[model samples]
Target chain A: MFSKILVANRGEIAVRIMRACRELGVATVAVYSEADRGALHVQVADEAVFIGPAPALESYLNMERLVEAAHHTGAEAIHPGYGFLAENPEFVRLCEEAGLVFIGPDSKAMALVGDKIRARQVVEEVGVPIIPGMKKSFPNLEDYRQAAQEIGYPVMIKASAGGGGKGMRIVYQEEDLLPALEAGQREAKAAFGDEAVYLEKYLEEPRHVEFQVLADHEGNIVHLFERECSIQRRHQKIVEETPSLALDDDLRFRMGEAAKKVMQAVGYTNAGTVEFLLDKDKNFYFLEVNARLQVEHPVTELTTGIDLVHQQIRIAAGQRLSFSQEEINQRGHALECRIYAEDPAKNFLPSSGRIIYLREPVGPGIRHDGGVYAGFEVPIYYDPILAKLITWGETRDQACARMKKALEDYVILGIKTTIPFLREVVQHPAFLEGKISTHFIPRYFSEWRPRPPSPEGQRLALIGAALREMKQGRERKRPTQLMSAGQDFLSPWQTLGPWRLGRRS
Target chain B: MNFEFMVDQKRIPVAIEKTSQGWEIDLGEAKVVVDAHWISENCVSLILEGKSYTLHVVPVDNGYLCYVQGELWSLGRPTQDLEYSQADQAGAVGDKLKVKAPMPGKVIKINVQEGEAVRENQTLAVVEAMKMENEIKAAQAGRVKKILVSVGELVDADRPLIELEEE
Candidate 1:
């Protein structure tokens, strides 16, 4: 194993990776941008390096700075946790050129999967089922119509350089194809300056399910299981769980095998996720590849009892597979809820501020991977994820119930969060019954509002507020864990409250 | 001590008196017995009539934000004791739409220029915070007078981005 590894990310994921390194007895280095100088990941690492300014382009995404930081810190390798430059092929190649092992797939494999069109062609050649679509964009309108008929109706015309849903249209029948194609091309020309458009079958009500795969240097590959992440807002997943309700044993095995096959074909190494869109008819189509440790990996870890970070490190250190595919088994069930610093009530707008108070939930069958502490000023320059609350149980219902109770126990004051909204999701009858799809959020919760507090609830809250109002003077700063661990006496922190917004009058 | 608060437009008047057992609280018509203790700076543990509940409350600006279960309730306002609110004061700045930011962030882009006519709901500027771009939109169709803040300028919550004269 490498003696020291540099974590090339921040937030909960960077902290999570360093924790795994500590367990393996490997010293870890953390790189931070200006906004994250006092971040949890920076404070916890064995060594820290300042990269650049708050803007990601000036820091985290700066490939040259990342490589230099690894070298200056004497880190043997760099672990791009997730986001930023994790899937950037140029960064992967830079690490390789600088002789610092990148704890993920090599640049060749990354480049192959990074290009959507090429990856689709490559995976299809390896017999992995792909979404039926045109391999390349066409300028002619008649060609799109012919391809749509072959691929069948309900086809989507998307710009080759599409983003932000621009230059995209879905047609259910032949009549809508020509006009839609012309509009898509015109929009594409005005938006991306690329009039070329591609055609593909659009699957309605498809669930976003993905498989976690691990590969060693010797080409040995195995899949842990599947995570159904259908609960998403604005194309970003918020809730994820393993052992998808939509998949039977036979279907699970097939999807798992297909995931491994895709990885094996590319000669990919380390931990990566192969995403699939499982449709209503039980058929699955390839979505894309996430070439790093996923945010929802804890669900896979809980079910399979495998440490993915440790495996990634070992694989980068040129180790062979320690176990076979048969040894891996999906245990009961595990669920993960991403606790982001965003308001769900106001169209899920991002909310940022100092964490005036924070209390993490704790108990058996519950694990919280948090990235911030009380008083940590959540910077306005990064991802809003503050933590992930994962729960395990012998059954899905048990996990669901545990998640609900744990969410109530979780307390993060000041900034708004998705806690109230998530609690409603886990308890929604349709979600509990496993009837969900990618449209789950829009279908069930577009007009959702936070339930009104009960009369008693309001009374207690107002009374609590009144007590603070009566407390003569106010303490301005945050309340801290001033008491040392295992202290017998009650410190002032336990008996006195400090942080208050101030009296209204 | 007597305190007044508002929740969703309803007025709540609470009176409290400290006692040896705990504190007795009077909610207008009814009186409730309670034992309350501060567990942390913003967390209070209260046992009301033999039932236990931990209420998380944080003092923010001129108001108190309280959390019960997953739901949040914000009490009071900047004009807590005043009968009229900022909403009523809006007429004072009438005929000019001051496009204010909803939160503190750096303005990454200005979508409109001075004297440009913009439709209602059209994006006026984009403020990037917490790695998300929040589009500041025009509430009514209007012509921009002048941009108040430059691109790349960091702004506080409610800082007006631009003033729009009615079009």
Candidate 2:
């Protein structure tokens, strides 16, 4: 076991990985940008390093600086926690060249599976059904149109470089193709710095289900079932759960086998996920493979009783399979809600400010992996996710109910958040029935406006207002004047006093 | 004292009074005891029915700075009657207007310039906030008055950015 490891990421994920390292009796070194000097993860880690300025390009995404920090600190391995340099193949290669283990899959596997088009082609060769679309990048508008025609209308144009819904668009007609393509390319270039894109058949109301696969360096692999990640906004998943309600025993087995086959095809090692799209008719198709730890890995961990991060570390340390596929048993259902500092009312635009106050939900089956604290400023230079709220229960419904209650108990002030919107989504009819898709938010909530407060609430507001006025009035009056006014029965508190009636009762 | 309050959009009546223990509140539907302590000139900590709530009350120019559970909620006071005087001046020519930023953000791009004609929904500027770019659009058809913010300038929300004259 390594004595110490460096976490080359920030926010809740860094805190999450540090916790795992602690339990495994390992010390952690955290790297942070200037904006994150006082962040929770930075404060909790055993040691901290100042990476760079606030912008990720000069900080978290700077691979050379991160490696240099690891070397200077004498760290044995570097854990790229999910985002940033997590799946960067070149970073893995650099880490290897430095004689430090990269706590994820090898560079070759990441390169083969990180590319969406190539991943799809490999999965199809393994006999896993894939979405009907082009295997090669379209050269021009005419090629794109021809591909879309063959795939039928309502085709999806997606960036071949990265995921997380960036640079992905659905075109309903030929007229919308050019603009959508241009916007997709522009967003892709800005987000991934790669303009390559491919076309695919867009499945309407398709549930997003993904299988979690864990493999040892020795080529032993197993799948940890599926997670339903259909609840999304703008193509980004907001909520996720394990044991998808949409999958039956047979379908689950089939999908799991297919995912295993895809992993095997790439000679995949360490923890990775194979994502798929499940249509209403129960047909499943390969979406892509995330060749690193995922944002929603907690759900799978809660269900399968597996510490995925621990497994990743062990595999990177040259450990073999700890458990066989048949030995792995899944327990109850688990759900995770991503709390972001974004205004759902304003189309989920990112909001940033100092966190004046925070109250995290606590109780049985509730887990909060958060990165911010009261007085910490939420910077505008990175992703807006504040925390991941996860809950586990004996059943799916119980887990959902617990998650809803937990969300209500959770509160953060001084910034807009998606908490209110997520509350509505968890209680939504379609969400309760596990019937959701990428279009869930836009389809159900696009025209739905939040109703105003009720009359009883108004009365409370009036009381609140009167209280304010009285407080102000007392402030304006001198002590002698306030004493003189207190002697009068016409005083605001004396005139319509409920205390007087209560004494009579 | 009896008070009318609006919750959501409905109006409700409430009554409250001091007691030996603390204070009592009646909502016609139920009665509850509350212990209130003044934390600051504009803030109070209240415990009602076993639940704790902190309220911050600041006197804004027009209304109240009502902070509840750490959130700054706005409470508008009912308007008072005042005498109104109508202006008789008309046919005044409009000159170049200066536009200010509505919100504080770093300007990512400028789409238009001074004396440029813009239609409604036309993108005039892009402001990057929390790592996402928000395109500021023209509210109505008008000719450019004046652009005040340049790319990379940080601006506050609701600050005017451009002045426009009717085309």
Candidate 3:
């Protein structure tokens, strides 16, 4: 076991990794940007280091700064918690060359699976079903149009260099193809700096299900079932769960086997996820593989009694697989709702401000992985995900009910959040029945306006506001009045029961 | 005594009468009981139907300082009457349309200049918040009359960012 490890990330995931490291008797070193000087993750780590400025390009993505921080702190290994620099193959190479263990798949494996185009080809070669599309690159409109005609209408133009719904477009007809391709290429160039794109046949209303796989240095790979990530908005996942309602015993087995095959082909190690798109007919096609830990890994952790991060660290330390395929079994249903600093009413745009008040839900089978406190200011530099509210129950319905209760119990002030939206989603009939897809939010609830507060309710609110104001006025007039009232242990309003002026009462 | 309370520019008249059991307050169409307990020299606790609400009072410039749910709100001397009335206006009568920001974020890029003609759904600006860039577009075909915000300026939800004149 390693004595110390460096966490090259921030936010809830960083805090999550730190807790796991402490439980495993390992010390953690946290790296932070200028904006995160007072961040929760920084305060929780055993050691902290200043990396760079607020912009990710200047700080979190600065591989040299991270490597130096690890070397300076004498960290034996570096754990890229998911996101910034987590899947960067170059960073893994740098860590390897510096003699510091990268706590994930090696640079070679990352390079193999990190490229979407290459990964698709490799997986298809291994008999994994892929979406019918072109594997070769489309350099111009002629090549794009030719491929589009062959792939049929409603083709998907996706960035070959990155994932996360960025640089992806869906064209429903020929007239929209060229413009979509152009826009997708532009976004891909701006986001990933590589304008490479590929074509894929669009499957209407497909559910996104991914398998969690872990391997060791000895080529042992085992999958921990699947997570259904169908509820999304603008290509970002909002809710996720394990043992998809779409997957039965036979289908689950087949998807699990396919995941293992992909992992074996890529010579994968540590913690990674193989994503698949499941159509209505239960036909699953291979999506790209994530080369690092995922944001929703906690759902799998709750269902399976395995510490994925601890396992990743151990695997990076050249340990052999501890559990066999037969030993791995999902005990119960688990679901996670990503609580973001966004307003669902406003197209889910990011919301940022100082948290003036926060009340997190707590009880049985409820887990909140958060990084912000009452006084923390959520900066606008990074992702707006404040925390992930996950709940586990004996069954799927029970888990959904628990998630709904947990969301209601959660409260945050000083900025608008998607709490109201998440509350509605968990209570949605389609979501409850596990009948969802990528278009769930935009298709059904896109125009679902928040119902206005009724006039009677508003009148009640006004009365309450007025009463509060009057009490405040009296207290201000005589500060000693409050002091004396405090001594009496009676409310000032109660003492002065009925004082009257006039009118309509 | 009957005192009328105005909140968020709306007047709410409440009637309070002393009773042997407690205080009976007529709040519009409902009658309820009020239980107040002094929490400190600056705060009081109000309990209603098993739920407790704490109120913090302090002195402000022209009125009293109030804190509800940890948020500081001000209550000044009653001046203007609180009323909600519909405004009668005409459509497309050479009036400048206010373009309020859809959400709180820092303006990243401004793609249009003042006096430039823009079509509906045309990109006007990009607001970068929460690590994603949201492109703000023109709601209707119009000419840009004024740009109220600049790049890198942090804005709140519904804050005016631009003004558009009918084409």
DockQ of each: 0.43, 0.22, 0.27
Question: Under CAPRI classification, how is model 2 graded?
Answer: incorrect
List per-candidate RMSD values in Å: 7.1, 10.0, 9.3
Model 1 complex DockQ against the native: 0.43
Evaluated on CA atoms against the true complex, candidate 3 attains a DockQ of 0.27
Which number leads on DockQ?
1
Q: Write the per-residue lDDT of candidate 3 for residues B2-60, one digit (tens) a residue.
A: 76644444555677765775556787788888676655554566776667766555433
Tell me how candidate 3 scores on lDDT: 0.79
Candidate ranking under TM-score, highest first, comes to: 1, 3, 2
Per-residue lDDT tens digits for candidate 2, residues A23-103, read: 787778999999898777787777889999877778998889999999888899999987677777888899999999999
Q: Give the TM-score of candidate 1.
A: 0.86
Q: Which clashing pairs does model 1 show?
A: A498-B41, A500-B59, A501-B59, A501-B60
TM-score of chain A of each: 0.85, 0.89, 0.89
- Per-residue alpha-carbon lDDT of candidate 3 for residues A279-341, written as tens digits (9 for 90 to 100): 988899998898888999989999998989888888888889888999988988999999899
Per-model lDDT: 0.82, 0.77, 0.79
Tell me the native contact fraction for each prediction: 0.56, 0.21, 0.30
